[model samples]
Structures are given as structure tokens and as C-alpha cells.
Target: MDPRLLELLVCPVTRHPLSYDKAAQELVSPKARLAYPIRDGLPIMLESEARPLDAED
Candidate 1:
């Protein structure tokens, strides 16, 4: 993933900063409790596409 693009990207639902989880290939939105998937070098930012985060996550 491009660092420049990561800097500009935010959580679509919360409009909050996203933390990249390289191991999981996801962009985590702590505020929204969602993890947006990153596939084929592209981020799937749609809320419907996001996975709900567990309390332990």
C-alpha cells in the first residue's frame, strides 16, 4: 500500500483516522469498530464490506 494514499484515507463511517493492519491487510477504524478490507492493493471502504470488530479486537 502507498504511504501517501494511507495518509489521505479515513474511515468512511466515522471519518476518523485509520490504522493499517498489514498482517491482516485491513484498515481498522477503532471508532467505528470496523475493519475495512484491503484487497489486491486496493481498500474496500464501503460500510457493507467492512467486518465488525469484536470487543477483544
Candidate 2:
């Protein structure tokens, strides 16, 4: 992901900043407890499409 794009991206639900988890290749929103997937270098930030946080994460 581009650094400029990362800076401009936010959680679709809460409009809060996201943390890029490079290891998981995801953008995590702690406030919303959701994980938006990064597929093929594109961020899927839709709340409806986001995955809920699992304890193991």
C-alpha cells in the first residue's frame, strides 16, 4: 500500500484512523473492533464487508 493512500484511509464505519497491520495485510480499526481486508493491494473498507475481531487476532 502506498504511504499517501494509507494516510488518507480511515474506518468506513467510525471514520476513525486505521492501523495498518502489515503482517496480516489488513487495516484494523481498534475503535470499531473491525478488520478490513487488504486484497491484491487494495483495501476493502466497507463495514458490511469487514470482519469482526477474533480473540486470537
Best by TM-score: 1
Candidate 1 Cα misplacement greater than 4 A, ranges: none
TM-score of 1: 0.95
Each candidate's number of clashing pairs is: 0, 0
For candidate 1, write residues 1-57 as lDDT tens digits. Answer: 888899999999889989999999999999999999999999999999999999999
Alpha-carbon lDDT of model 1: 0.95
TM-score of each: 0.95, 0.87
User: What are the per-residue Cα lDDT tens digits for candidate 2 across 3-54?
Assistant: 8998999898899999999998999998899999999999998888789998
Stretch of 10 with least lDDT, candidate 2:
48-57
